[model samples]
Target: MKTVEQLLQAKGHKVISIAPEKSVFDAMQSMAEYNTGALLVMRDDELVGILTERDFSRKSYLLNKPVKDIQVKEIMTRHVAYVGLNDTNENCMALITELRIRHLPVIDKDKVIGILSIGDLVKDVISEHQFVIEQLERYIYDTPEI
Candidate 1:
C-alpha cells in the first residue's frame, strides 16, 4: 500500500531526462552515465516521451542510419504511461505488467516529479512482503495459548 510519493521519498526524486531533439547516441550515453535503462524525454520541463533501452534496441538498432543520425523523439515511446503521487505501488506494478513497460514517469499537479522502474516497484513489493512476514512471525510467537 505504499504510495508513489513514499517510494520516491525512499528512492530519491532524481529524474534523469534528455531532450527529445537529442541524438539517440546522446541518449544512450546519458543512460550509461546514469546507470539507468530509461530516460524521460523532456522538452523544456514538459514530458513529451520516454527513451528506453528497448526503444533503442528495437527502433534504433534496426535502422540503417547511425545512432547519432536518429533523434530521441524518432524512437522514444510517445504514448507514455505515468503514475501520480497518490498512486499505490500495486497499481504501478499492474500498469507496468499490463503495458509491458519498464518505466513510468511520476507526475503531480501537472508536473513531472520522478520516475519509477520495474525494478523499483519489484523491490518495494518485496520489502513490503518481508515486513508483513516478519510481523506475522512476531505475532505468532508472542501469542499465548488459552
Candidate 2:
C-alpha cells in the first residue's frame, strides 16, 4: 500500500500558508494565485487553522460578516483535521470521507509537511489501479501455457 509520504514525494511537498491575522480577502487572493481550494492558516510558523471556500460561504452566513470585514482567524476552521506521513492512502481516504472534509494537513512530529485533498487521493488511486491493470495484462501476455 502507498503511504502519505510516498504521495507527498511524488506530488512534491509544497505548502502555501497565510497568516491568521490576514483578512479573508487575503486568503482568497492567495488561494486564487496558488490555484488551490484551501490555505493553511499560520500563526508564527505554526498551523492554527484551515481556510477553504466552504468556510467562506458558511462562516460568512453564520457570522453575518462582509468578506472585507472578516479575518481568516474568524472564519477559518479552527479544529483542523490532519494525517501523518506513515498513514496509508486508504486511511486518508477513509478519514476524509468520515470527516466530510476536502483538505487534510500532513504532519510529522508537529511539523507541517504537506497537505492532501480529496482530489489528490482520487488521482493517486486511479493511477495506481491503472498501473496494476497494465501489469496484469503484461503478465498474462508473457505467460506461456500457464
Superposition TM-score, candidate 1 onto the true structure: 0.95
Candidate 1 positional error at 87, Å:
0.8
Model 2, TM vs. native? 0.94
lDDT tens string, model 2, 19-137?
98888888899989999999999887699999999998788777776777788898889999899999999999999999999999999999899999999999999999999999999
TM-score per candidate: 0.95, 0.94
Best by lDDT: 1
Superposition error at 122 for model 1 (Å): 0.9
Segments in model 1 whose C-alpha atoms lie over 4 Å from true places: none
